[model samples]
Target: MSKRLAQRADSRETEIAAVAADALEGRVPAGSLVCGDPDGVVEAALGGPVWNRYAYDGRPAQPWPPEGAFPGAVLRQPRGWGAFAMTLHALAARLPEGAPLWIYGGNDEGVTSIPKRLEGLFGEPETLAIKRRARVLELRRTGAPARGGLEDWREVVSVGDAELVSYPGLFAHGRLDPGTELLLGALPKIYADQSVLDFGCGAGVIAHTVRRRVPEGRLTLLDMDSVALHAARQNVPDAAHVLSDGWSAVPAKRDFDLILSNPPLHRGKEEDFGALEALVRGAKDRLKPRGALIAVVQRSAGVGKLFASVLKNVEALAETPQYQVWRGGV
Candidate 1:
């Protein structure tokens, strides 16, 4: 990894610690709301037994802002601009007038640009602290309740013959991505009764394609993001959905005849191969004896080596200047 990427990978905990320290030092008020806190770090730092929590991903927390009043809110900035904006809007709508909103994030995650987006709904933010290349800012809810409901952000896009419903912050939101289009075009024929799992399925595009090809086949869609999964549920209602981080929430007894994806490569602003690597390594245990795992990735991802390490009969199914499709069978 490059020096910057290495620092990004290593600095998450440190950045969270810095935010937590500020929260503990009286920046965050008691009975505050919180979101994007991995492992509840900020909540723990606040010395609270319980706090109103919201999560966009498949964490053990509320999917929407809780109904009630809060003295303030502490938000760990989300990766995508859409996710962050949605969360901010939701908080603004729910928080009482003058309630403090404490937002913090790494500089690389675009912490400094937050105030610009807050122009209408929040007062000018006060810079609380800047440490460990991370920053914390305090602002008060000012504008009238903004339209922050999930339906408010809904978008629909046409892909081939299908119209997919998606929200912002989702991969390739409102359109089909080139890598996925390549993967779809090059997909192998599916048997009518085969079981297929769309690993890291975003908005169920891959699973939807598989469904049209083999309507009788049992389909499963898995992803960590609740918002994307919500869109997937609308687009492909027949497929079983699993909100999980990797295979953590998937039942071990379940196995698939085929698994496919255009796997995610980035976590926040940094290139993260951990999820992709884990998916490749764990496919062996999740696939049936003759099942295969197929995926599309950037040409430079070096995914072929990982596929070869665990899966037998690995081969490149298709290739382009910018992307490659790989398939590996057990």
Candidate 2:
């Protein structure tokens, strides 16, 4: 896309958000709604692009959200009516009626359900134009407004002897991701104070685990999505982070003591393996002599072939019914 066209597109996303914001001009929404999506449009417009949902998405990239805490002012919750409870609680605190309640997402992500959910929360919703994948909703105050607090969607999910508290859009929320499990199980012993890199750390499972096991090790994480990177920071404290597409920003000559990743396959219409290949090509050069590249992938994805061709030595181990754990060392 041309620079001017891209700027206009970004501007249009804001315009789309304004439609719903205006709909609630009279009162803060008693409830809110968000879909299972990563479309940057909703938060981008409502509050500015301060919130990122695409980070650590099922991809290997760097983490870029600044390491910090965000105001709970903008409440984030799960899909469906649960979001209503959190949104209502936010409104109850300070944002008043006509404060303009909002719900956002793409069409494919079930933004259409926002209108229906709003019908139950406040009243029928007023919808704006449909975009590529989402929609927005604004509720009228004439409808019933029940008191709702944050308790609506809070739940504990099991993650390998751990109970993780989650609300919405947290990867495999309330539970552990399969790929993450594989990566965790494959972690090799590394000395403390060594620089370790999480190539595509998502939800920070690997990064957090590494931090606990090797607190002295300088942990550096990378991911593609802004939201995932943000979540990673929250999940894995004290680790250095970068946001980019799978070590794309790291110089080819830069070396690391260890690299871990679960490479992503889907890229739009085609499944691009470039990230994995790039990892293999640069990993050898980047490693500290005997540094390792640990990764996991589905057996059907034929990760073994790539590992064999890329590393000085490749070891394949079975983690689960579907995953193959591959570790390459120089």
Candidate 3:
């Protein structure tokens, strides 16, 4: 398994593992929906595929699980508060009356107050278990979900004159990220007819800016996360949107003149740069000769070292206390 999958498997041995195991074995039921799957560990424990579907092609279609289609759902709390709130509301909105929704995570994963968060929608939640430094809570929907507060998590925002659609759980959902802003500010002038790929395009903010700045460039937005891509489509309607885990999923024959990214470095509360490293290591092969790869990465992320290990030359284009934009070409 990859590092991401390995970390998720390791989490299954924690305090709430036994309860989760038991719930997966019987209580959660087959055909129940699973949201925010953590490395397919939950799906494997459930013993088969469940009702897990993702929105496609940056479209808002099926953004939430269908209402009352399943008796219950199992959710792994996301690290972001916006993601957590959105997940909670989405689960509540879809679950049938009296059906249970279970949320599980460790204290270190930043999910200790989930029960409190669910109280308004589901009344007092039931503490299922607390062990091995982890906690599990169950809430049964008794009435329609209280959705009055969910609008905040689903609002679109204006970033540098671009009206970008954002949803909870997307990185920097409501606004532009500083790293992305820095990258946009420092983007080298694009020559005519260049093909640009926005790798890990979150909410299409970078793609939107690139298209505006380089109108002659053909833009393609790619991201592993369906929600991010969905948001991106709204921001850059004219650009192509590709759903991909990494370079592996991109078309083998396609090459780009410019590649851009604000590569993800975190999975929940855990920091893992393997994905970013993979992108850096494989980037040169995907670019045409004289083509460049540009990215905004955290200064402490060792991105310079990663780039230096793979590329002959890596140049720092712009810097802030929190981030830096780096560019390199074959």
Candidate 4:
């Protein structure tokens, strides 16, 4: 491993990535494919041009798979089991017989059992490396017939009277979460011609619900995950979509009359409030003069104070034992 990777392996956030980098030390070839490289460690360690695909828009790589064949491929395990399975199936279908495939992840991410899962299609994974509580395994593609794609994971979820098409890996994938349900029930009256923005729209449930109330209104759905954006497109076809991290992809001049969300608070397995904090702090700039930001969150998150710090007329719209709906006006 390079000196930089050696240092990264000791860090909590990039330990798995460093392990992946170390495992591929002398094996990576030019034009290799890499997926789910959240920290770009694998690509940087490869030291060559690579075709990379990332689900989150935060990465500079393509969101969808690129066209072409590769000599080898590396996949950094994702947090969601369904996403991992779907990606594995897709890679199995794409790779040619005998092509090397490397998979790596932290122990906490279920990496230890991956060998059993790889036995059928890849013939059996060879243990490559284990360090820093992370493991890397290598296998050769057997070219076995792969079963499904994104469409196979599609589920039609019913939220109240609205039916939404969702797929695996999205937040609240096959059903509505209680927080969003409460927010929906307590939604304020919206004008027919008002413009609305659904921040962190997972599968378009919130946007779809609001769309029914405002047929003449302009709707924009924003999310960081391409998979969630894909489902949002299908669920609310008429609405505009923006694949962004926080408010990065939103146009500065584009202000909305209302913004709604059940914003994400977790990054992988760790509780993260960065996105939520950014949304609250930046909502004032993104909203029109009379606009308001309405959202539902855990009652214990203490988000009401954060909202009051940056926005005016902040109040709790509704509350349940586990959740609270808050509205902050510009």
Candidate 5:
């Protein structure tokens, strides 16, 4: 496999995607399978059969298991901050007691001690390790039957007071992001009621904020990453959730009153402003006349200048040495 294609689970979304890919390739088997992190599993080896793991986002994901749904079981883990933590929760719930559970990961990702920590919870592990950063561990767990999953989501202290239900692989492990804070603080004045689309709505913070600010507003949260969208569903319960590459699932010529985002600028290292720029251009089509689009990016990105012709007005609400809040108002 090409090194470029064999991605590591650097983040939660990547982790989910990676594991999904691995399941497809055949690296991980279908029996007694519950990957600690889907993304890691996906990118590991290659696509293979996957089963008995849950990927949850509070609201059920479409095309969710059932269709081509593998036999063992796939479910959403209980609410939590880290994918590892959540995955452990999933395993606790799904694994038959006393029927050993195995967790695998890269050493650079700190898997060496995961087994030790796990042994405390599930009993000592049948462990294995090797160079090139890999470890395999199996815990001898008692079949107490999983107690249950977390009933409620937790709120993060930072990141503009954004709310997130914990899930495996999300950054800050159950909290808000600082970059999001800078963006939210500079959000333009949105009306009390409007049709809004939140692209790349990670864990649904912006969507939740919008819904809270405008109780009657129709909100559509779109994200390509299942884990993010799953979190988005929890984060934006009132909003409609769509899984597609940036607006791909959205209908064209359907206008929105407001579109907000702290759009991501990179995809695993190749700086990708393509989606953001596409939004800058196509967003006009999705906006009712004179509607607005708000965004946050590093100052050096110069996105406003790049899309000057597409937008009627582009201004900076907040600017620092490193970042800028640019609003594209029609």
Candidate 6:
């Protein structure tokens, strides 16, 4: 397997494609399952193979795969360890006897424990390929192990008057986020008939609270992570949920009275402000003339400058020890 891996000048996406192509040629049988490919990259890599492309990110609301047994599968390792572990269980439980389940991820993508984790599940995991800072692991399902399923990771938390259900991978899972609490506290008393947009509606915490506060307000929940959206779908069932890449998934012509977000500041272990910056810059276009973008962020993240660059006026509505809820508008 090591000999088959060769260093190549290819983007991460391309490396992922190469891995997929190789799997199709050898281990991964035809009509196998593909998990967490919301972007359809794995399917495209296999040259449009007929397979169950199970994706969760908010973009498309595909039902969870059937709970029957499957011959084999190829899965992209998720960034969060909890999500990754949950995915491994999800794949393993559905695998038939002696079926190979290929899990792939970059080192930086938080899959360093593939060996130990897979060993506990499938006796021993086979290293398939190691190239371009990425590795593919092969685990053949053989026996049942005492592994906690996704249900074990589930929790119900009460915030304000709403009880939100969240899984391990979801942001702030099993706990209330201080920033979101601050943002929710800072929100105006009444929304009435206004339209509300929860930009990064993790577990629909903000959406649920706001809906209770403003029952007449039309709520639209958006998030790039399918896990978050999946939780949001249940937490705020009546709200319009959208799976999008930042502002791309939202319709430009559809203006909103208010935009609320507790935007994530990190991508995996790296500190990334791309999502937050995009939200600030793009909010004006989606907001009505009097509409405002309200967000809770770390005060030291220099979000004021970001808000100033996009909106003519920016106001810090509330501040805590580590967070500030800012409101900006044209």
Q: In candidate 4, residue 3 scores what lDDT?
A: 28
Residue 284, candidate 6: alpha-carbon lDDT: 82
Candidate number of the best TM-score: 1
Question: How accurate locally is residue 295 in candidate 2, as Cα lDDT from 0 to 100?
Answer: 84
As a whole number from 0 to 100, the lDDT of residue 208 in candidate 6 is: 87
TM-score of each: 0.91, 0.59, 0.86, 0.90, 0.64, 0.81
Model 5 bad stretches (over 4 Å): 1-30, 34-81, 98-102, 123-147, 150-176, 224-237, 265-285, 299-312
Question: Per-residue CA lDDT of candidate 6, range 95-193, in tens?
Answer: 766888777777777556877666355647777787767778777887776343555657787755567888767787777788998888899865677
> Against the correct fold, how does model 6 do in TM-score?
0.81
Model 5: ten consecutive residues of lowest lDDT: 62-71
Stretches of model 1 off by over 4 angstroms after superposition:
1-10, 47-58
| lDDT, candidate 1, 74-156, per-residue tens | 88787778777878887887688899888888887798999888747889999878877788888998856687677887888
The ten-residue window of minimal lDDT in model 1 covers: 48-57
Of 5 and 6, the candidate ranking higher by TM-score: 6
Off by over 4 Å in 2: 1-51, 55-108, 118-158, 163-167, 266-285
* Residue 251 displacement (Å), model 1: 2.6
For model 6, the stretches where C-alpha displacement exceeds 4 angstroms are 1-27, 37-41, 47-63, 66-69, 118-120, 145-154, 159-162
Worst 10 residues of 6 by lDDT: 1-10
Poorest stretch of ten by lDDT in candidate 3: 52-61
Going through the candidates in order, what is the number of backbone clashes in each?
Answer: 0, 32, 3, 0, 32, 4
For candidate 5, write residues 96-118 as lDDT tens digits. 45555555444445656665445
157, model 4: CA deviation in Å?
Answer: 3.6
| Per-residue lDDT of candidate 3, residues 1-330 (tens digit) | 235643654464333445565555666767777765545556567753343324322322234555555777887666677777676776777666788777778777766777666646665667777767677777788785545333445677777677778887777866778889899989888866888999999788888887777776789998877677777887788888877767656755438999999998765555667678877877878888888899999898857876787776789999999999998887
Cα TM-score of candidate 3: 0.86
Model 1: lDDT equals: 0.79
